[model samples]
Target chain A: MYVILVYDIGQKRVGKMLKLCRRYLHWVQNSVFEGEITEVKLKELVYEAKRIMDEDQDSLILFKNRDAKWMDKQIIGQERSPTDQFL
Target chain B: MYVILVYDIGQKRVGKMLKLCRRYLHWVQNSVFEGEITEVKLKELVYEAKRIMDEDQDSLILFKNRDAKWMDKQIIGQERSPTDQFL
Candidate 1:
């Protein structure tokens, strides 16, 4: 499944959430992550998220798509160029 | 339909995109907006978005859900309490 995760958390907790997400997905933008993962991973991610969350001061939204093709994604600006070291 | 709009653009253009989205949806978090909008209004929003976008330096993504109930939203932390100026 393709999952889009967006989070609104306290400023102090930002780093922790970002690190947790980066462990499982690519960092697309500020507090927003999208990528493919299995149902099991999704559950694991959610579990970890719940553990870290304040439960009373944060919001986390996940939009799941059965397939990436079903979603139309548009990029308008210049993205960071891939590192030439890999090339 | 419930629409989720997310964007990544130049720092200089952030204000314009934020303003444009604020006109149609609630500002839920940084670079994220969500609300219910009609198909016609969606088109209008897209058209206006195209006009403001740099096309080569920004990215705008819209996720459309047929219904809000289909999506699971979780809030983990404290949200702003509604103010009652009258009360």
Candidate 2:
């Protein structure tokens, strides 16, 4: 599945979460990450994310799509980092 | 349906997109706007967004969920803004 992950975490924990996510997916934007992964990998990412986050303080939103073609994307301004080399 | 909209637009056009989105949903975070919207309203939002965006430069990603319950959200750090008063 293709997953879009975004998170709002404390300054102290942001680094950890970033590292955790980067290890599993592409860091497309600040506080945002996405890419394709197996069900098992997704679960593993969530588990690791849960362990790294302060549940009461940080918030994470994950959107899963069967494939990227199902999504309609529009790009207008300055392009930051590319979505992903593989995507 | 519930929609989660995120955009990476140019500085000049972002303001316009923000205004268009704020008129319909809550501005939860930078570049992220989301809320419950009807199919008609969703189309309206998309139409307006397309007009405001620089098709070649900006990127918009919309995630639709029938309901928030289908999502697993995790919060870890400082909360910037409430998701929405009603949600």
Candidate 3:
């Protein structure tokens, strides 16, 4: 199972999400705001991400198959972000 | 450059995006809510998508890259959506 989390949010806390993903597994990700994580690894990623995330609004975790050719982009922010190169 | 459009929307318009892409290029896609389109092809996708969108709210186009391993998921909607398979 693959996961694509569109956690509808602003720009301030992108770092928080990325760090959380890093804490768990090796992922090919994009967008600190909107994450393209797989479901097999999602439970761990979300658990960690939720730990750092403040209780403000609701976020959605969209799940898909890994076989699916799913991709995400960074539209609103600057280029060459620190979050670009994933571990 | 790669593009990931988080149009911050509900569930009614996912189909609108996939149809527009099929009109343009042969892409490997995921959610219609958040699109995983390449920057080279972004201009065509965004232009056509913007035409169908109502413009009621502010949407963002977050551009990252193709080299970047960005992915997206389908969190809120149901399973086996028509928007899953891209042409």
Candidate 4:
């Protein structure tokens, strides 16, 4: 499936969360990531994320789609980190 | 269209951006918002966002879909703000 993950982590653990997410998905912008992954990999990514997050203060949201083509994306300002680097 | 808007704004201007986005979309979490809006309204929101943003330093991304049913949302941790409050 294709997924877009957005996170709001506590300042102290955000760096760790970023590193963990980078291993599984493309970092699209600050605290935002998106890419295609198998169900197993997605679960693994979420497992790691839970470790880096404080349930009381941090939030993590995942938007899933069967494929990227199902959605349309637009950018109005600087593309901090382009997800289509290879393409 | 149903749109999910994510922003990474400089600290100095983030508050203004948040206030502006709230008027057009549901606040799902920190720096993230989603809701149904007409094309004209989306354009207006983008126009206002551009004014509050520094093109060189900030980034705004919009993910649009024909309907929210096309995508799935999963929250792993705290949902800072619930989007389906009315539902």
Candidate 5:
């Protein structure tokens, strides 16, 4: 099964996640990874990436279950953290 | 165009979003609201809901563009604020 790691990144650290993960694993063009990804491994990736996120900013990482019928299109939105207040 | 507000709620504040918006507008059962929701009005709904989120927690709100081909099925996942990582 393909594991899609969909991220709502903090914008500033977009490529940092890629740099850290790409050397050790193969990443799909759309930011997904297929094959076995243990919970332990995912934690490591997030932990390392955490350094890139500012306390004022954070990132969202969703490990999508590709085996399931998921929406294939890229969803879009932008509400600068503070800006999201208005919804 | 239908403005789809997809929220990654801060666990404690789900109903707050619905309660505030449902009164003035009609909401679809699957967490999507369709109507001419002006940005000005949406801000009011979000602003009111934020009072319920904890200082340690925040919410992610995406105003899904419904005209686009979006996956209509319910997407599921549970991640505590500091837990997601290894993938």
Candidate 6:
């Protein structure tokens, strides 16, 4: 699936979350990541993300589409940390 | 269309961006928002967002789908803001 993951983590744990997510998805900007991955890999990413997050304070939301083609993306202003390589 | 918007703004201008986005979309997490909107409204949002952003330093991305059903959303940990009203 193609997933767009947005995370809001406590300051202390955010670096770890960023590192973990970078291994599986493209970091498009602050607190946002997206890319295509298999089901198993998605599960693995979630498992690791959960371990890094504090359930009481942090939040991670994943928007999944069967494929990237199902959605349209637009960017205004700068394209920080571009993910065009994934395209 | 259903849109998921994420933004990275300079600290000085972020508050304004947040306030503006809140008027047109549901705040789902820090710097992340989503909701259903008409094409014209979406264009208006882009216009306003551009006015508040610095092209060299700020970035805003919009992921648009024909409808919300085309994507699946999963939340882990605390949901900083609930957007069930839009659903």
In model 4, what are the clashing residue pairs, if there are any?
none
Give per-residue CA lDDT, model 5, range B19-83, as digits (tens): 76565344533333334455577567556656655534443343323232332222222221332
Docking class of 6: high
Candidate 2 versus the native: TM-score?
A: 0.65
lDDT tens per residue, model 1, B1-87:
777788887788788888999888767667888788898998888888888888777777777766665555544454432221110
Question: Candidate 6 on B1-87: residue-level lDDT in tens?
Answer: 999999989999999999999999999998999999999999999999999999898999999989888899899999888556334
User: Per-residue alpha-carbon lDDT of model 4 for A1-87, expressed as tens digits?
Assistant: 888899988999999999999999989888888888899999999988998889888899998878778788898788977456221
- Every candidate's CA RMSD: 6.2, 4.5, 9.6, 2.0, 13.2, 1.4
After superposition, the stretches of candidate 4 with alpha carbons farther than 4 Å from their true spots are A85-87, B85-87
Q: Taking the tens digit of each residue's C-alpha lDDT, what string does model 2 give over A15-53?
A: 999999999988776677777888899889889988988
Against the true structure, what is each candidate's TM-score?
0.71, 0.65, 0.36, 0.92, 0.33, 0.95
The DockQ ranking, best first, is 6, 4, 1, 2, 3, 5
Q: Candidate 3: lDDT of B53?
A: 57
Worst 10 residues of 2 chain A by lDDT: A70-79
Give the per-residue lDDT digits (tens) of candidate 5, residues A50-87.
67655344433433232323322222222223211111
lDDT of 1: 0.71
The candidate that wins on TM-score is 6
Task: Name the lDDT of candidate 3.
Answer: 0.44
The DockQ scores of all candidates, in the order shown, are 0.38, 0.32, 0.19, 0.79, 0.06, 0.89
In model 4, state the lDDT of residue A80: 76
lDDT of 4 at A76: 79
lDDT of prediction 5: 0.42
The better candidate by TM-score, 1 or 6, is 6
Query: What DockQ would candidate 2 receive versus the native complex?
Result: 0.32
Query: Across all candidates, what is each one's fraction of true contacts kept?
Result: 0.54, 0.38, 0.32, 0.84, 0.00, 0.94
Residue B42 Cα positional deviation in candidate 1, in Å, after optimal superposition: 3.2
Task: Residues B31-83, candidate 3: write the lDDT tens digits.
Answer: 32333455556766666666765556424344333432443343332232244
